[model samples]
Target: MSDVAAYPVTLPAFVPEHAPPFPGQPPAIARAPRSDTLRCSTCSMRAICMPQGLTPDELKRMEALICPSRTIRQGETIYRANDSFQSIYAVRVGSFKTVVMHRDGREQVTGFHLTGDSLGLDGVSSGHHSCDAVALEDSKVCIIPFHLLETMCREVKVVQQHLHRMMGSEIVRESSQMMLLGTMSAEQRVATFLLNLSDRLRLRGYSPAEFHLRMTREEIGSYLGIKLETVSRMLSKFQRDGLVDTHGKDIRILDHESLVRV
Candidate 1:
């Protein structure tokens, strides 16, 4: 592994006045939401995940179907490929990357999941998970029992509709990634990836313009369908062109609009 400390990152302080507050935005603190409850009833991410718009009574009922959040250390597998799928997980802290291995032993990264993201939805169609959910850092996840969730969905229209929407959103995201891989140039792909990550960080109450990248350049290349050297070259070009500042895992986006145009 490369020694990340060898690179020093320059990140600017977040200036909130530059943009109007987004509706339903959480606090501006750059950390994962506080986990004060074992269930969705009191979660800080309730506005983003399943509990959004749910009634107090409904949240209480949801507690029954959820197991106490479980912690997964870095490099730990939340669920291995082909494991029987029982529950979908809601990321409560930290991030994770999902990967799939083929018969010949080659592995491809599927997705990077952050707080409020759902994992294991792919297993709903089949009985087993197709990808491995591995923690990118020390993480905690709320295990939502699928069987009980299904029962609730039948009784609650919101539950059923929300679950369908979540699944549909995942499908749409995958389709967008397919487009990114098959169509965009390496520089454009990197730009799009940065924009997407920035947007996600913004929603999670982190600084959109400055943040640490948890994934390595090789991992980013694998996910973006580019070579590692190409990724490195484009990043250097971006820095030289005044688009971003990078140091090891840390990045500071200098021109969001210029990147969008690339």
Candidate 2:
């Protein structure tokens, strides 16, 4: 059975509501990678998810802080709004969508996360999660207890910087989405979304020109602040214009420059 099928939807009990205070300064990282440590050290997404320039000893120490990975099936939630934030997760496989519910019970998809992306940062400031992270498919995530991570950050300047960069990236992404919703045309918004996904996939060593959409048209519309029909219409226009070819959820960008022009 797949890991998702093997595990239940319920999240296992995690760290306490109040984590212990940060410990004293630790020694610097070592120089070589270790074969026996946690999967984070040998993970293919290590470069994207972890800080660079760590020695073997430092890498080992970082790996020690990670709890075993968790798996969830499609549509299952990894975390819910208002839950106490004890840890952050790195998407180790598949995709997820973070959504927030309006006061009237409408669901708004705030963002989509793919492999190597980080989740649960929204809770960092308030100590409670602000949105729900639901699996887009059968997925796995590496759990990094936040308090332990903070302790490591205090001892390692590089780790601290990387954490800041990750947080900054999230802010920039949200800003861009706001701009897209407020100013961009329907076609432009759709094109930009596809291009953004393509670029991110390329960075992760996946094919840039073609991939399957993990989220539905309705979900895409929600994230882009457009109607579901508008998303479908814009995609049809792109395909008709020979900029892209779509089959069901599959998308292939045929003319990158043309799509950019749109």
* Top candidate, metric lDDT: 2
Residue 33 deviation, candidate 2, in Å? Answer: 25
TM-score of each: 0.84, 0.86
Tens-digit lDDT track for model 1 on 1-262? 0000000011132211111113454222222333434556567676667735667777677776676666667777777677677777788888888898878997688888888788878889898888887788988777676887899999888888878878887878888988888888999999988998998888878899999998888888888888889999999999999999999889999999999999
Pairs in clash, predicted candidate 1: none
User: Model 2: residues >4 Å from true position, as ranges?
Assistant: 1-38
lDDT of each: 0.74, 0.78
Give me the runs in candidate 1 sitting further than 4 Å from their true place.
Answer: 1-37
> In angstroms, how far off is 124's CA in candidate 1?
0.7
Worst 10 residues of 1 by lDDT: 1-10
Query: lDDT tens string, model 2, 1-262?
Result: 0001000012333433432112442111111212223367668788788898888888778777776666656877767788788878888888989999999999999999889888888999999989988889988777777987899999998889888988888778877887898999988989999998998888789999999999999999998889999999999999999999999999999999999898
RMSD (Å) of each candidate, 1 decimal: 13.1, 9.6
Candidate that scores best on TM-score: 2
TM-score of 1: 0.84
